[model samples]
Target: MTYLPLPQPRTTPVRVMTIAGSDSGGGAGIQADMRTFALLGVHGLVAVTAVTVQNSMGVKGFHEIPLDVIAGQIDAVASDIGVQAAKTGMLASSAIIDTVAGAWRQQGLAGAVPLVVDPVCASMHGDPLLHPSALNSLKEQLFPLATVVTPNLDEVRLIVDVEVVDDASQRDAARALHALGPQWVLVKGGHLRTSSRAPDLLFDGTEFREFDAPRIDTGHDHGAGDTLAAAVASALAHGYTVPDAVAFGKRWVTECLRAAYPLGQGHGPVSALFRLNE
Candidate 1:
């Protein structure tokens, strides 16, 4: 029997892994993460934590992957293909969080790989993604292991009990989240009316730097969060420093937002299709 020919050698040295739920709508989750990774020039690997059923309307339901299966996927990739960086989204439960955290520690990837933890709490439509009981596990188990924790205003309130209203409060909120032990915490000000531009605060336990973009007046930005976190992961995989990675992410997601499009009955998704232009 004839065997298939071996593929050519890879020129890409950077591999970024996304540990996330599947979005059937293709607007967010792993779908969005993959798009961001590819556009940013990295090989994307996945460890699906859950499968979500939803559209622009909202998340109707979701089925989490089995604990062992989730852990196995992570191990499978780490031991063989090997990722340079990893990011997480939509960890469905406390048990899943513990399992993923355990796998990270066991693989000695906790402080090794640059881990971008997007503490996804709710959807843009205000639907819950993580279970209430999982919050503590996320903070206690995952945050300490993260290179950065990117929390939007809503997640900032949920995770650290700080309501970000203005610039000073945004700074305060970033400080509160830093205490949880991530090397850096990015407090997203996308939803905050603190300024005319979309301002985001990055805190490295001590210093605070703000990154902002021209706030494109639009409502069709469903995948913005996933895109930002994924872009950061991609940058990290390509050897950018944490601050520089985040800076690249901010610029990338801003372009994505500018290209946002309408989808269904509710809000649509941001676009990375803009990269086609560049």
Candidate 2:
């Protein structure tokens, strides 16, 4: 016999859902989340909250989708498709946050799904993405339901009601924010001025874990946060603990930033597809 045929086993895909906005540039928001999931070998799903007309320069404008439609999309996915992990981002308004939180509760997927909340309060280009009212709504409606809330310095200020200037301040802010009911809180220090490293602090309602990486000097980075959040979710979906997820996620984003390709005239995007050859 020249050869024999053998049956190959099928592998189940890791399911991940991202509830966020759509970036017209295809560099951030829903697109970035989906891309990150794909790069990490996970099946991606999305429930868009808004549509933004933005580019590397900045956000020109945005339109929030109807709350009902947002709810329908979330429920439709959670009910049928199902997900191993879920992430929330760019909640354009209080209404959207309220709707998503309500769905999570009513659908009883609260503790079942590993929820990562990337509290995207505003864009790095000084464009206000979330309204003032949405801040209160986020705390009341979404914070309590999150498995982990990832907030940058600016966002941590809003969430914890304190200014984060350094690592110590980040620890304090993390503790205060954890009081709001998130199982764990991660304070991203990318906005802080440091020598040559980007540091992120994670407070797991107990001890603090600091994640550090040699900063990649590049302005062509837009979807970095979304990528980090998605990568963390993917790791968690694969049964990695929170600390391990953060460590691996940071390494992943560092590589992404290091391999970023210039796109527009202004701020570009991190390379989510950098590991393709590997």
Candidate 1 has what TM-score? 0.95
| Cα-based TM-score, every candidate | 0.95, 0.95
Candidate 2 C-alpha lDDT tens digits along 5-78? 12234766788899999999988999989888887778898899999999888899999999989999889988
Per TM-score, the best of the predicted structures is 1
> What is each predicted model's overall lDDT from 0 to 1?
0.90, 0.86
Clashing pairs in model 1? none
Worst 10 residues of 2 by lDDT: 1-10
Regions of model 2 farther than 4 Å from truth = 1-10
RMSD of each: 5.5, 5.0
Query: Which digits, one per residue and each the tens of the lDDT, describe model 1 over residues 133-229?
Result: 9999999999999999999999999998888899999999888888999999999999986578999999997788889988888889998999999
